[model samples]
Target: MTLPSAYTEAPARRFNVGERVRVKLAFPPGHRRTPVYVRGKSGVVERVCGAFANPEELAYGFDGNPKRVLYRVRFRQRELWSDYAGSESDHLELEIYEHWLEAA
Candidate 1:
Protein backbone atom coordinates (compact mmCIF):
# COMPACT_ATOMS: atom_id res chain seq x y z
CA MET A 1 0.00 0.00 0.00
CA THR A 2 1.12 3.57 -0.63
CA LEU A 3 1.97 5.85 2.22
CA PRO A 4 1.61 9.58 2.53
CA SER A 5 4.52 11.71 1.23
CA ALA A 6 5.05 13.12 4.70
CA TYR A 7 5.87 9.72 6.15
CA THR A 8 9.41 9.49 4.84
CA GLU A 9 12.52 11.61 4.41
CA ALA A 10 15.58 11.54 2.16
CA PRO A 11 18.75 10.25 3.77
CA ALA A 12 21.20 11.97 1.46
CA ARG A 13 21.60 14.80 -1.00
CA ARG A 14 23.69 15.13 -4.16
CA PHE A 15 24.54 17.62 -6.91
CA ASN A 16 25.14 21.34 -6.55
CA VAL A 17 24.16 24.67 -7.96
CA GLY A 18 25.41 25.54 -11.48
CA GLU A 19 26.59 21.98 -12.07
CA ARG A 20 26.22 20.63 -15.60
CA VAL A 21 24.22 17.44 -15.64
CA ARG A 22 22.23 15.18 -17.91
CA VAL A 23 18.90 13.52 -17.30
CA LYS A 24 18.82 9.76 -17.54
CA LEU A 25 16.83 8.39 -20.45
CA ALA A 26 14.53 5.85 -18.89
CA PHE A 27 11.07 4.46 -19.63
CA PRO A 28 10.54 2.04 -16.80
CA PRO A 29 7.00 0.92 -16.17
CA GLY A 30 4.94 2.34 -13.31
CA HIS A 31 5.16 5.31 -10.95
CA ARG A 32 7.13 7.56 -13.28
CA ARG A 33 7.71 11.21 -12.43
CA THR A 34 10.21 12.37 -15.04
CA PRO A 35 9.12 13.97 -18.26
CA VAL A 36 9.82 12.04 -21.47
CA TYR A 37 10.79 15.12 -23.45
CA VAL A 38 13.57 15.95 -21.00
CA ARG A 39 15.10 12.52 -21.05
CA GLY A 40 18.73 12.34 -22.19
CA LYS A 41 18.89 16.12 -22.23
CA SER A 42 21.75 18.05 -20.66
CA GLY A 43 21.24 21.05 -18.41
CA VAL A 44 22.64 23.03 -15.50
CA VAL A 45 21.53 22.77 -11.89
CA GLU A 46 19.93 26.07 -10.92
CA ARG A 47 19.27 25.18 -7.29
CA VAL A 48 19.16 22.38 -4.72
CA CYS A 49 15.59 21.95 -3.58
CA GLY A 50 16.25 19.55 -0.70
CA ALA A 51 15.11 15.97 -0.34
CA PHE A 52 11.61 14.61 -0.70
CA ALA A 53 9.97 11.23 -0.90
CA ASN A 54 10.72 9.45 -4.16
CA PRO A 55 7.63 9.70 -6.31
CA GLU A 56 8.79 6.91 -8.57
CA GLU A 57 8.85 4.55 -5.63
CA LEU A 58 5.80 6.02 -4.01
CA ALA A 59 3.64 5.31 -7.00
CA TYR A 60 4.11 1.60 -6.47
CA GLY A 61 2.82 1.74 -2.88
CA PHE A 62 6.23 1.68 -1.18
CA ASP A 63 7.24 4.00 1.62
CA GLY A 64 9.54 5.88 -0.75
CA ASN A 65 12.05 5.61 2.00
CA PRO A 66 15.35 7.41 1.91
CA LYS A 67 13.92 10.31 0.02
CA ARG A 68 15.85 11.60 -2.95
CA VAL A 69 17.33 15.01 -3.54
CA LEU A 70 15.49 17.24 -5.94
CA TYR A 71 17.19 19.80 -8.14
CA ARG A 72 15.95 22.68 -10.17
CA VAL A 73 17.54 22.06 -13.53
CA ARG A 74 17.53 24.60 -16.34
CA PHE A 75 17.53 23.72 -19.99
CA ARG A 76 17.35 25.69 -23.20
CA GLN A 77 13.89 25.47 -24.73
CA ARG A 78 15.35 24.68 -28.15
CA GLU A 79 17.27 21.75 -26.75
CA LEU A 80 14.14 20.08 -25.38
CA TRP A 81 12.25 20.16 -28.68
CA SER A 82 13.16 19.62 -32.30
CA ASP A 83 10.75 22.07 -33.88
CA TYR A 84 11.27 25.30 -32.02
CA ALA A 85 9.16 28.38 -32.65
CA GLY A 86 9.68 30.31 -29.48
CA SER A 87 12.29 32.96 -28.74
CA GLU A 88 15.87 31.67 -28.51
CA SER A 89 16.09 33.18 -25.07
CA ASP A 90 13.32 30.97 -23.79
CA HIS A 91 14.21 28.39 -21.13
CA LEU A 92 12.60 25.53 -19.29
CA GLU A 93 13.24 24.49 -15.73
CA LEU A 94 12.22 21.35 -13.90
CA GLU A 95 12.52 19.68 -10.53
CA ILE A 96 14.43 16.47 -11.15
CA TYR A 97 15.44 13.83 -8.64
CA GLU A 98 19.10 13.01 -8.09
CA HIS A 99 18.64 9.47 -9.45
CA TRP A 100 17.41 10.95 -12.73
CA LEU A 101 20.46 13.20 -13.11
CA GLU A 102 24.11 12.55 -13.88
CA ALA A 103 27.25 14.52 -14.61
CA ALA A 104 27.34 15.84 -18.15
Candidate 2:
Protein backbone atom coordinates (compact mmCIF):
# COMPACT_ATOMS: atom_id res chain seq x y z
CA MET A 1 0.00 0.00 0.00
CA THR A 2 1.07 3.55 -0.73
CA LEU A 3 1.76 5.95 2.14
CA PRO A 4 0.49 9.52 2.26
CA SER A 5 2.36 12.31 0.52
CA ALA A 6 2.52 14.33 3.74
CA TYR A 7 4.95 11.75 5.02
CA THR A 8 7.34 12.38 2.12
CA GLU A 9 7.79 16.15 1.62
CA ALA A 10 11.13 17.76 2.41
CA PRO A 11 11.63 20.25 5.26
CA ALA A 12 12.29 23.93 4.69
CA ARG A 13 14.08 25.14 7.85
CA ARG A 14 16.21 22.29 9.13
CA PHE A 15 18.96 22.67 11.73
CA ASN A 16 22.43 23.34 10.44
CA VAL A 17 25.32 20.92 10.56
CA GLY A 18 27.23 21.03 13.84
CA GLU A 19 24.52 22.85 15.75
CA ARG A 20 23.65 21.78 19.29
CA VAL A 21 20.13 20.66 20.10
CA ARG A 22 18.02 18.84 22.64
CA VAL A 23 15.25 16.34 22.08
CA LYS A 24 11.82 16.67 23.73
CA LEU A 25 9.93 13.48 24.28
CA ALA A 26 6.18 13.47 24.69
CA PHE A 27 5.26 11.88 27.98
CA PRO A 28 2.61 9.69 29.60
CA PRO A 29 1.64 6.69 27.54
CA GLY A 30 2.68 8.06 24.18
CA HIS A 31 4.82 5.70 22.11
CA ARG A 32 7.23 8.11 20.48
CA ARG A 33 9.95 8.54 17.92
CA THR A 34 12.33 10.11 20.41
CA PRO A 35 13.52 7.00 22.12
CA VAL A 36 13.31 6.63 25.89
CA TYR A 37 16.95 5.65 25.66
CA VAL A 38 17.85 9.24 24.74
CA ARG A 39 15.56 11.28 26.93
CA GLY A 40 17.28 14.25 28.60
CA LYS A 41 20.43 13.62 26.61
CA SER A 42 22.36 16.35 24.85
CA GLY A 43 23.55 15.97 21.28
CA VAL A 44 24.89 17.74 18.22
CA VAL A 45 22.94 18.43 15.11
CA GLU A 46 24.64 16.43 12.37
CA ARG A 47 22.32 16.78 9.34
CA VAL A 48 18.89 17.88 8.26
CA CYS A 49 16.29 15.42 6.97
CA GLY A 50 13.68 18.10 6.27
CA ALA A 51 9.99 18.22 7.21
CA PHE A 52 7.46 15.42 6.98
CA ALA A 53 4.07 14.71 8.46
CA ASN A 54 3.79 14.47 12.25
CA PRO A 55 3.72 10.91 13.50
CA GLU A 56 1.37 11.66 16.37
CA GLU A 57 -1.41 12.78 14.08
CA LEU A 58 -1.10 9.75 11.87
CA ALA A 59 -1.28 7.55 14.92
CA TYR A 60 -4.75 8.85 15.72
CA GLY A 61 -6.10 8.57 12.17
CA PHE A 62 -5.50 12.17 11.23
CA ASP A 63 -3.31 13.61 8.48
CA GLY A 64 -0.52 15.29 10.42
CA ASN A 65 0.35 18.90 9.95
CA PRO A 66 3.85 18.88 8.54
CA LYS A 67 6.52 21.02 10.13
CA ARG A 68 9.16 22.90 8.14
CA VAL A 69 12.28 21.45 9.70
CA LEU A 70 13.86 18.11 10.64
CA TYR A 71 17.32 17.15 11.80
CA ARG A 72 19.82 14.37 12.19
CA VAL A 73 21.20 14.64 15.71
CA ARG A 74 24.39 12.89 16.69
CA PHE A 75 24.76 11.70 20.26
CA ARG A 76 27.48 9.72 21.94
CA GLN A 77 26.60 6.08 22.20
CA ARG A 78 27.49 6.22 25.86
CA GLU A 79 24.97 9.01 26.39
CA LEU A 80 22.10 7.06 24.93
CA TRP A 81 22.66 3.39 25.53
CA SER A 82 23.67 2.27 29.00
CA ASP A 83 25.62 -0.70 27.72
CA TYR A 84 27.30 1.15 24.85
CA ALA A 85 30.51 -0.64 23.92
CA GLY A 86 32.24 1.87 21.68
CA SER A 87 34.81 4.56 22.32
CA GLU A 88 33.98 7.92 23.92
CA SER A 89 33.65 9.49 20.51
CA ASP A 90 31.33 6.83 19.18
CA HIS A 91 28.10 8.47 18.06
CA LEU A 92 24.60 7.63 16.95
CA GLU A 93 22.51 9.71 14.59
CA LEU A 94 18.79 10.06 14.98
CA GLU A 95 16.39 11.60 12.46
CA ILE A 96 14.41 13.94 14.69
CA TYR A 97 11.39 15.96 13.77
CA GLU A 98 11.50 19.68 14.53
CA HIS A 99 8.78 19.70 17.14
CA TRP A 100 10.89 17.35 19.20
CA LEU A 101 13.74 19.82 19.61
CA GLU A 102 14.69 23.04 21.35
CA ALA A 103 17.77 25.21 21.85
CA ALA A 104 20.21 23.63 24.27
Candidate 3:
Protein backbone atom coordinates (compact mmCIF):
# COMPACT_ATOMS: atom_id res chain seq x y z
CA MET A 1 0.00 0.00 0.00
CA THR A 2 1.18 3.53 -0.82
CA LEU A 3 1.33 6.23 1.85
CA PRO A 4 0.41 9.88 1.26
CA SER A 5 2.86 12.62 0.32
CA ALA A 6 2.73 14.12 3.82
CA TYR A 7 4.62 11.11 4.93
CA THR A 8 7.61 12.12 2.79
CA GLU A 9 7.69 15.93 2.72
CA ALA A 10 10.34 18.13 4.26
CA PRO A 11 9.36 19.33 7.71
CA ALA A 12 9.78 22.88 8.92
CA ARG A 13 12.90 22.60 11.06
CA ARG A 14 13.14 23.98 14.57
CA PHE A 15 16.87 23.40 15.13
CA ASN A 16 20.27 23.72 13.48
CA VAL A 17 23.52 21.79 13.36
CA GLY A 18 25.78 22.39 16.37
CA GLU A 19 22.85 23.61 18.51
CA ARG A 20 22.43 22.12 21.96
CA VAL A 21 19.13 20.43 22.82
CA ARG A 22 17.53 18.29 25.46
CA VAL A 23 15.51 15.21 24.71
CA LYS A 24 12.15 14.98 26.41
CA LEU A 25 12.07 12.69 29.39
CA ALA A 26 8.77 11.19 28.33
CA PHE A 27 7.71 7.55 28.20
CA PRO A 28 4.37 7.79 26.52
CA PRO A 29 3.56 4.36 25.08
CA GLY A 30 4.02 3.13 21.51
CA HIS A 31 6.61 2.88 18.74
CA ARG A 32 8.81 5.94 19.21
CA ARG A 33 11.81 6.80 17.06
CA THR A 34 13.74 8.23 20.00
CA PRO A 35 15.28 5.55 22.11
CA VAL A 36 14.31 5.28 25.79
CA TYR A 37 17.92 5.49 27.00
CA VAL A 38 18.36 8.95 25.50
CA ARG A 39 15.31 10.48 27.07
CA GLY A 40 15.96 13.52 29.25
CA LYS A 41 19.55 13.65 28.04
CA SER A 42 21.30 16.70 26.63
CA GLY A 43 23.12 16.64 23.31
CA VAL A 44 24.25 18.70 20.34
CA VAL A 45 22.41 18.67 17.04
CA GLU A 46 25.00 17.11 14.78
CA ARG A 47 22.92 17.42 11.62
CA VAL A 48 19.38 17.94 10.37
CA CYS A 49 18.62 14.82 8.38
CA GLY A 50 15.36 16.04 6.94
CA ALA A 51 11.75 15.08 7.74
CA PHE A 52 9.55 12.01 7.61
CA ALA A 53 6.25 10.77 8.95
CA ASN A 54 6.08 10.53 12.70
CA PRO A 55 6.76 6.90 13.32
CA GLU A 56 5.16 7.02 16.73
CA GLU A 57 1.90 8.02 15.14
CA LEU A 58 2.22 5.99 12.00
CA ALA A 59 2.65 2.84 13.99
CA TYR A 60 -1.04 3.10 14.83
CA GLY A 61 -2.05 3.25 11.13
CA PHE A 62 -2.78 6.96 10.93
CA ASP A 63 -1.17 9.25 8.42
CA GLY A 64 1.31 11.21 10.52
CA ASN A 65 0.74 14.92 10.78
CA PRO A 66 3.22 17.81 10.58
CA LYS A 67 6.11 15.47 9.78
CA ARG A 68 8.85 15.28 12.35
CA VAL A 69 12.31 16.67 11.76
CA LEU A 70 14.96 14.05 12.24
CA TYR A 71 18.23 15.20 13.79
CA ARG A 72 21.46 13.41 14.48
CA VAL A 73 22.27 14.33 18.05
CA ARG A 74 25.62 13.73 19.69
CA PHE A 75 25.88 13.00 23.38
CA ARG A 76 28.78 12.17 25.63
CA GLN A 77 28.80 8.55 26.70
CA ARG A 78 29.60 9.64 30.24
CA GLU A 79 26.53 11.86 30.28
CA LEU A 80 24.29 8.95 29.36
CA TRP A 81 25.80 6.53 31.82
CA SER A 82 27.34 7.74 35.04
CA ASP A 83 29.78 4.83 35.24
CA TYR A 84 30.69 4.70 31.58
CA ALA A 85 34.03 3.02 30.91
CA GLY A 86 34.90 4.93 27.76
CA SER A 87 37.09 8.01 27.58
CA GLU A 88 35.62 11.44 28.20
CA SER A 89 35.94 12.08 24.49
CA ASP A 90 33.73 9.15 23.68
CA HIS A 91 30.24 9.95 22.43
CA LEU A 92 27.11 8.35 21.05
CA GLU A 93 24.97 9.60 18.23
CA LEU A 94 21.22 9.13 17.86
CA GLU A 95 18.65 10.22 15.30
CA ILE A 96 15.88 11.91 17.27
CA TYR A 97 12.71 13.59 16.14
CA GLU A 98 12.11 17.31 16.78
CA HIS A 99 9.08 16.79 18.99
CA TRP A 100 11.21 14.72 21.30
CA LEU A 101 13.67 17.56 21.82
CA GLU A 102 13.71 20.93 23.53
CA ALA A 103 16.12 23.86 23.68
CA ALA A 104 18.99 23.12 25.99
Candidate 4:
Protein backbone atom coordinates (compact mmCIF):
# COMPACT_ATOMS: atom_id res chain seq x y z
CA MET A 1 0.00 0.00 0.00
CA THR A 2 1.12 3.56 -0.77
CA LEU A 3 0.04 6.97 0.46
CA PRO A 4 -0.25 10.11 -1.58
CA SER A 5 2.19 12.93 -0.96
CA ALA A 6 -0.04 15.88 -0.28
CA TYR A 7 2.67 18.13 1.14
CA THR A 8 6.04 19.19 -0.22
CA GLU A 9 9.44 19.45 1.43
CA ALA A 10 9.77 23.14 0.56
CA PRO A 11 10.05 25.57 3.44
CA ALA A 12 7.18 28.03 3.71
CA ARG A 13 7.31 31.75 4.43
CA ARG A 14 6.49 33.09 7.90
CA PHE A 15 3.38 35.00 8.75
CA ASN A 16 3.20 37.97 11.09
CA VAL A 17 1.77 37.89 14.57
CA GLY A 18 -1.92 38.83 14.90
CA GLU A 19 -2.40 37.91 11.24
CA ARG A 20 -5.80 36.44 10.40
CA VAL A 21 -5.80 33.04 8.63
CA ARG A 22 -7.58 29.74 8.24
CA VAL A 23 -6.41 26.16 8.87
CA LYS A 24 -6.73 23.49 6.23
CA LEU A 25 -6.67 20.02 7.70
CA ALA A 26 -4.88 17.18 5.87
CA PHE A 27 -6.06 13.77 7.05
CA PRO A 28 -5.26 10.42 5.49
CA PRO A 29 -6.97 7.11 6.13
CA GLY A 30 -4.43 5.49 8.49
CA HIS A 31 -2.70 8.31 10.42
CA ARG A 32 -3.05 12.04 11.10
CA ARG A 33 -2.13 14.80 13.53
CA THR A 34 -4.60 17.58 12.71
CA PRO A 35 -7.47 16.60 14.96
CA VAL A 36 -11.04 16.19 13.78
CA TYR A 37 -11.95 18.91 16.28
CA VAL A 38 -10.28 21.63 14.21
CA ARG A 39 -10.73 20.87 10.52
CA GLY A 40 -11.26 23.88 8.25
CA LYS A 41 -11.12 26.29 11.16
CA SER A 42 -10.17 29.98 11.15
CA GLY A 43 -7.67 31.49 13.56
CA VAL A 44 -5.13 34.24 14.29
CA VAL A 45 -1.35 33.89 14.05
CA GLU A 46 0.09 33.72 17.55
CA ARG A 47 3.76 32.78 17.90
CA VAL A 48 6.40 31.55 15.48
CA CYS A 49 7.86 28.18 16.60
CA GLY A 50 10.50 27.93 13.86
CA ALA A 51 11.49 25.12 11.45
CA PHE A 52 10.14 21.56 11.37
CA ALA A 53 11.31 18.73 9.13
CA ASN A 54 8.63 16.81 7.29
CA PRO A 55 7.70 13.79 9.38
CA GLU A 56 5.83 12.18 6.55
CA GLU A 57 8.86 12.33 4.32
CA LEU A 58 11.01 10.71 6.93
CA ALA A 59 8.51 7.93 7.32
CA TYR A 60 8.46 7.40 3.58
CA GLY A 61 12.22 6.84 3.52
CA PHE A 62 12.90 10.23 2.01
CA ASP A 63 15.19 12.80 3.60
CA GLY A 64 13.17 15.78 2.47
CA ASN A 65 14.11 19.41 3.11
CA PRO A 66 13.25 20.91 6.45
CA LYS A 67 10.20 23.16 6.56
CA ARG A 68 11.08 26.50 8.17
CA VAL A 69 8.17 28.59 9.42
CA LEU A 70 6.11 29.62 12.43
CA TYR A 71 3.73 27.87 14.75
CA ARG A 72 1.27 28.39 17.68
CA VAL A 73 -1.80 29.78 15.93
CA ARG A 74 -4.50 31.12 18.24
CA PHE A 75 -8.14 30.67 17.39
CA ARG A 76 -11.35 31.52 19.17
CA GLN A 77 -12.82 28.58 21.05
CA ARG A 78 -16.12 29.33 19.39
CA GLU A 79 -14.47 29.26 15.97
CA LEU A 80 -12.94 25.79 16.32
CA TRP A 81 -14.80 23.76 18.91
CA SER A 82 -18.43 24.47 18.09
CA ASP A 83 -19.54 23.31 21.52
CA TYR A 84 -17.00 25.46 23.34
CA ALA A 85 -18.07 26.31 26.88
CA GLY A 86 -15.72 29.20 27.53
CA SER A 87 -16.60 32.87 27.08
CA GLU A 88 -16.80 34.43 23.64
CA SER A 89 -13.57 36.26 24.31
CA ASP A 90 -11.82 32.97 24.97
CA HIS A 91 -9.50 31.57 22.30
CA LEU A 92 -7.58 28.37 21.59
CA GLU A 93 -3.96 28.00 20.54
CA LEU A 94 -2.76 25.43 17.99
CA GLU A 95 0.75 24.65 16.77
CA ILE A 96 0.12 25.01 13.09
CA TYR A 97 2.51 25.07 10.11
CA GLU A 98 2.55 27.57 7.25
CA HIS A 99 0.94 25.15 4.79
CA TRP A 100 -2.12 24.81 6.99
CA LEU A 101 -3.08 28.45 6.64
CA GLU A 102 -4.76 30.54 3.95
CA ALA A 103 -6.30 34.04 3.86
CA ALA A 104 -9.53 34.19 5.81
The candidate that wins on TM-score is 3
lDDT assessment of candidate 1: 0.82
- Backbone clashes in model 4, listed as residue pairs: none
lDDT of each residue in 8-80, candidate 3, tens digit only: 3344688877899999999987787788899999999877777878888799998987678888899999989
lDDT by residue for model 1 (1-104), tens: 11233422334656767789999998888767788999999999877777888898788888887788888789999999878899998899998999999899
- State which candidate, 1 or 4, has the greater TM-score: 1
Q: Report lDDT (CA) for all predictions.
A: 0.82, 0.70, 0.84, 0.66
Question: What is candidate 2's TM-score against the reference?
Answer: 0.74
Q: For every model shown, what is its TM-score relative to the native structure?
A: 0.84, 0.74, 0.86, 0.71
TM-score, candidate 4, is 0.71
Best candidate per lDDT, number? Answer: 3
lDDT of 4 by residue, 1-104 (tens): 11333433334565766778887765666334456777788877666666676555566676745654646678788887778888999877777757667877
Higher-ranked by lDDT: 2 or 4: 2
Worst 10 residues of 4 by lDDT: 1-10
